[model samples]
Target: MPSAGIPGWSVIIPAYNEARRLPAYLDEVVAYFEGLDRSYEVLVVDDGSSDGTATHVLEAQAGHPAVTLHRLAVNHGKGFAVRAGMLAARGELRLMADADGATPIGELKRLEAAILAGADIAVGSRALRDPSVTRQVRLHRKLSGEVFNFLVRRLGLPDVADTQCGFKLFRAEVATVLFGELETIGFGFDVELLLLAQRRGYRVTEVAVNWADQPGSKVTVFRDGPHMVRQILAARRRLARRPSASS
Candidate 1:
């Protein structure tokens, strides 16, 4: 079990048509956090999954009380689901991770410790060096990641290595403020959120984390890749036209 102190955390998992995997993933999340000293709650955001994803989550509630379900009647993007969950969460620390379990929820300590040390936001990064470097990503995905990171660096964001990592934790104050400024509902949500955080002058820290590639991936590489690039450019224009925090 992944144990931590009392009043531990509020975890959010956003799912879109994940009926096949939500059953087991939710179980692992709840069971792993069972014996912790922390009082935690898990909110499953069913992002308009038509294939009985909400039904499965509701059925599982028969066994787990700490888990709650929030259904968005329409399919909103990942960012919208996460923003809704985080804003509703009442924990001292708010966490929004993926339903895929690519990054184990247990390793949240890396981010938690960063927040405890005064960072407002702490995000996971598989892009950093480690023994599992090669296993972190496949060739094509890795190539796409490098290109995106290069552009992000060129646009003035050098501290963030992996903006798309599913694992991230934020203090309540930070979550409330940043989630308010979020507009993108798609794949580029992280990039905009990070850029907005920088605009707001929040101390966002990136922590390297353990990762295991899982199947049933949702990102459409070819389609979303171009769309993400557009988002980055749009974000740049938004920042340039809007007043920055330091300004």
Candidate 2:
């Protein structure tokens, strides 16, 4: 059994209609944390999934006390779901991972190591080329991602290579502060969060990790791309108006 008191880690997964794709990943996450002695909690936020997503998490909770479910009344975007989970998380280290499990749960070690090394935020990147990291991405998705990232750099966050990676680790305090102030409630929230971190003078590091393109992606390059770009621009304007700590 995990030790009593505060949990060492909180894994927040934002799921929307992920009944078919989430179960295996949820089990994998639970199995991974079960082997370790440290305390951890998995908060699977169901963004009003029309399927049995909430029911599945409830059933898992019966066997694994650490697995909890937070259900939204209506389908909010991934960002809103993740923000809810982050704010509700009680662990010292908070991690937001995709329900599709694009990045393996084992990769948590790399981000965890970054946090332990004094970084405030550690983001998993598929853009960074590392011999140890294996990435199996679809050609079309790869090209679209490259184009989108180029825009992201040109607009803001030139320092960040891959802002859309769903795997990110943050210290509890940082998670609270960033998510609490978060305005973007869509897929573009990652860019805004990183921008806020930069303005807050927090340390952010990108680590290459193994990733594979998963089927049944909710995002469409043609449909959601423009929306994401608009959200990023709006976030930039809003943040620009607000004075940073240094100011």
Candidate 3:
């Protein structure tokens, strides 16, 4: 439930040089939320984009007052941008969405249902095979994602099928706790977040959602895959040093 004057949902978009790709998604998000009766906000966290990303967001804000822009001083990783937005959001439910809009904003209903049902965190998964869920992914990207998820399962978070998916919804307090303790500031941050959630006994539900591989993606498997793997290993070591809530 949202406090008085506070929005029920906050969509957090972490953008880095996404001027060419973000506008359409922003419009889609605004349109979807406008149809609903509940109050909502869109927080676009510009990750020091040299492009006109911030300017575009400002222009959108002129039209839609619910659209807010949070500019980062320097180009940090996606994890850092999302953490900043999550911490700054005023909504009861915070949704972290990719700027490229791989998953349609309409799919938010599925994650929201999971959260309303009982989950503290609702992760949108592309790997889950649900008759109602559809995924159109490239072969290479799909293969790489499978291999990476296998590594993730071996490391930890075995229950989560798609740990790298950027679409995830978190309850207000859950977002604060998980992101406040976040250390992996790169692409592999999702693995660490799930690990921390598991350690703290948060109810995380994986929901199958419709996803499509969009053009102009920031991640290149061949280039960033190894770096993400290293980050995951580093996060494991860091968590190993920390005591769990039960401990």
Candidate 4:
């Protein structure tokens, strides 16, 4: 169990119609965290899936008390689900991982180490190569990622190499502050979060971790891509006008 005010770690997964894929990842996360010397909690925020995603999460709860489920009445975007879970999490360290388990659960250690070393946020970066990632992504996906990262660098956060990695860890206080103030409710939330972190003068680090592109992903490059680009540009302008802490 966690000490008085904090769990050792909180794992938050924002799942949208992930019934077929979420179950196994849940088991893997539970098993991995349970063996650690400290206490942790796993919260799955179901983004109003018509499929049995919520039901599956509830079933997993019966066996694992640390596992919790939060259901949205309608399909809010991934941003909404992740923000809700991040605010609700009670861990000293909060991590957001994709339901697809593209990055292995075992890779949490790398992010955790980065935070322990003083980064307020630690993001998993596929751009940085590591032996852990066994499968390389398809050409189109790789191209899109490079394009997106380039935009993220030019228009928004120049320091972060990969904004959409789906794997990030934040100190509880930092996560709460950033997510509480978030305005984006779509795939671009990752960019917005980092933008907020940079605005707040928080240190963010990128670490390489194992990742495998999974099938049945919800993102459509042609559809969501342009929207995400707009979001980053809009957020940058919005943040620039806001008064900073130093102001």
Highest TM-score scorer: 2
lDDT of 4: 0.89
The lowest-lDDT stretch of 10 consecutive residues in candidate 2 is 238-247
Error of 4 at 191 (Å): 0.6
Q: With candidate 1 superimposed using the best TM-score fit, by how many Å does residue 23's alpha carbon deviate from the native? A: 1.9
- Between candidates 1 and 4, the lDDT winner: 4
TM, every model: 0.92, 0.98, 0.97, 0.95
Per residue, candidate 3 scores C-alpha lDDT tens digits across 1-247 of 1124889999999999999999999999998888888889899999999989999999999889899999997998999899999999989999999999999999999999999999999999999999998889999999999999999999988899999888999999999899999998889899999999999999999999999999988899988999999999999999999876650
Model 1 misplaced regions, further than 4 Å? 1-7, 131-136
For model 2, state the Cα shift of residue 51 in Å: 1.1
What TM-score would candidate 3 get against the native? 0.97
Q: Candidate 2 local accuracy as lDDT?
A: 0.93
**Tens-place lDDT digits, model 1, residues 1-247:** 2323434678999999998877887887887678676788888999999999998888877677667899999997898899999888777898988998888777787889899898999988888776633344677887888888888878768889888888899988888888877877877888888998988889988888888777788887898888887887887788788866651
Name model 2 segments beyond 4 Å from true: none
Which tens-of-lDDT digit does each residue in 1-247 have in candidate 2? 4426889999999999999999999999999999998899999999999989998899888889999999999997988999999999999999999999999999999999999899999999999989999998999989999999999999878998999999999999899899999999999999999999988889999999899999999899999999999999999999989877540
Query: Which runs in model 3 stand beyond 4 Å of their true positions?
Result: 1-4
